[model samples]
Target: MSPEPLRSIHVVAGVISDARGRILLARRTEGRDLAGRWEFPGGKREAGETEAEALIRELQEELGITAEIGEPIINVPQQYPDKRLRLDVRRVLSWKGNPRGHEGQALAWVAPEKLPRYVMPPADRPVVAALLHPDRYLVTPSPADVDDETWLGALQRALESGVRRLQLRMPGVDAERRRRLARAAVEASQRAGVEVLINSDIGLARELGAGVHLRAAQLPELSVRPLPDAQPVAASCHTGEELRRAEDLGCDFAALGSVRETASHPGGSVLGWEGFARLREAVSLPIYAIGGLQPDHILEARQHGAQGIAAIRGLWAD
Candidate 1:
């Protein structure tokens, strides 16, 4: 017979942003699990409480403030040694009264960019990514046949369509032409205040002072991260072992999938949402659901514990 399912806790949290663009965080009280680690303020949802209702009540009880909770930002599912945690985060549209430590927890208002510096529980990390990182990661198709002008034009269009993070993936193209395209793409992405990562090319990435996205094969070949902290490093992972290695290599995020059959990988194994979530629980790195995905799937992806959706054809423009 199958073993009993692990007990799960449904917790609600709120992202309280001030006019200065800082987020409010509360330190876990001394005796709590993960004590002293900062997190978005809130608590476990009691039965019969809606996520919004739970968040509102939690804010009032923990911080002595009444919150008008807004839309859901992300729902993160994490597995611990003892139990499972489902963290539902929402936006705090507005609130009344000064936020103080009603429960004796220390309070901090941190800048969005600096949230990484403060240690947090595994479930809270993905919520931070949802708030600061883009919901789409656009991977460029090979530019081997297309002229320079046509390829760059498509890149420009993708940027205008709100692709904040990008991967310059030209797998079959020759090195020289790829470098030429990379130089131009990097220049255009920088002008638009977007971050571009080179796919499987550490030297080029270093030369261009850009980020790198490693292939799964490269995960075990390197002991240290290829780039500095200022330059992001991403990876493509297919299994929990690969995901763990990517995490060990200090990858900022990972792209996992073949979530569905696609033209590129016909009949390849598809993870489906359940498989994706299962692997997601094994690591803490923010992940993007790739393969046969489009912009419309971002909400579904996030619900399944993905950071966002990563796509080539789905995001590519003419």
Candidate 2:
């Protein structure tokens, strides 16, 4: 039988930053669940407390600083077997006083890219990805039908529009043609300051000084991360098991779903918004809702805990 649904306890957290782009993290005390693990500093909401109120209060008590909470950035709902936690995280845009571990816990101000080096509780994982990347992910559809010039032009235009993260996937091409396309795409992306990943091609990604995006089937066979820590590694995940594997393998982010129908996969089984939320709640990694999402669904997707939306046709057409 399936486990019973966990009752959520609302907790407010803050991603406090300093002038040098460093985020503050605190170690849990001796008596809490997952103690000694590092996490974004904040605490549970008291009776009738608003999110901002609770966040500010928690920061003052725990960090010995007066925090100015910005609008709620993201809400993370996680199941911990014994309990469920809804971590309502916000950006602490500014604050007063030097942040200290008033509760006698350890504290660190870490660079955003170096956050992955520190071990954290499961729930804090996604927040790291969200901090570093606050933009949509673009996936290029098959370029076989379109001419090379036309395809590259469309991709360059999209990159110019601030699509910072991209995955280039072109199937049914000869190995030589694929490499040529990959090289061209990476060149175009670099000029616009975008990070590029190759779909399930480890060697090619390495050769291009790019990243690798693993297909779900690739997760189980790998015992170690495919790329060096300096590079990014992403995965395509569908279920809780896949997500867990992605974490174990040390992926940077995941593109999850068929959250809605799309022309690419006509009449495909769709996860819908609610199904997407259920799957999202199961893991801590940043997820980009795939399947048929457009730019407009970004807010709604984030509302359900996705970091951002990842699209093929949606991004290409736009």
Candidate 3:
């Protein structure tokens, strides 16, 4: 039997900032749907209200503050077991009143780096990731397939370009070869404080203290997290179901794409920008829009609720 159609709940939330560069968070009051969970302080949109208007109203009502809503970022679309949600998160440009919890909920203003210490609601997790993580992800063009030094050189260049997160993907290679390259990649990445993931290899990921990226094919086989809770576990997802699976399996993030047609996969059905936004709204994990993308897409990706863009080509072609 098919699941019931999701009832979409549109919400407008705000990331309020202060002069010291800290962001505000609010805890849900008791008896709410996500009671006790921390969130970017704001509320649902009342009918006939614009997103910015709703945000301003929600902030004034909930926190007894008047805020000027700024640019929208990370327009998240997430689904709970019972209902779906569209969390439109905008940055609060400025405010005139002190932000105090008028509804008895607690509010805290903390540095962005400290956001991970707070236990946020599921839908807000990706928003936090977007706030703290790099917008672009580099998936090494199949290490072996790219020829010996081509990939390694590209790896160094990409890291030098300030790509802080990367993945090394190689398949059907000898164990020894895979180990050699993984070690090299890991070593190269750590020198720059880059977080690297080894594709589909739990043993290698653990041995190297790196993360593991599960392919879509690996999703159905996992019953629990494949790595230590502290280690990042990202997944490749092409559908909402796959994104849900990634979230359920305790993935740190997921990449969803091919956002547009690529030379490599000509005529393949593309998600486009709108399609990416729609799929992104369906899940909470930070998602990177992949396939046929470039540096300029970063801002657009964030606007549509993505951590950023992921790519194999052009990412390293400096």
Model 3 misplaced regions, further than 4 Å: 1-7, 81-83, 143-150, 171-175, 273-278
Error of 2 at 202 (Å): 2.6
Q: Which should have the higher TM-score, number 1 or number 2?
A: 1
Give the Cα-based TM-score of candidate 3 against the true structure: 0.88
Which digits, one per residue and each the tens of the lDDT, describe model 2 over residues 78-188?
778777788888999889898988899999999888998888987787777777785489999888888788888888888877789999999888898889999999988
Q: Write the per-residue lDDT of candidate 3 for residues 1-318, one digit (tens) a residue.
A: 997797879988999888999999999999988888889988889899999988888898998888887887787777677877878898888898888999999999899999988887778988999889888999887665666577678789889989999989877667897788889889999998999999998888999999999999999999999999768999999998998899899898999988989999999988888888777766668899998999898888887788999988858753
Candidate 3 lDDT score relative to the true structure: 0.87
> What tens digits encode model 1's per-residue C-alpha lDDT throughout 207-286?
99899999999999999999999999999999999999999999999999989899988988999988999899878899
Give the top-scoring candidate (TM-score): 1
Q: In order, what lDDT does every prediction score?
A: 0.92, 0.86, 0.87
> Residue 13 error for model 3, in Å?
1.5
Q: Give candidate 2's error at residue 70 in angstroms.
A: 1.1
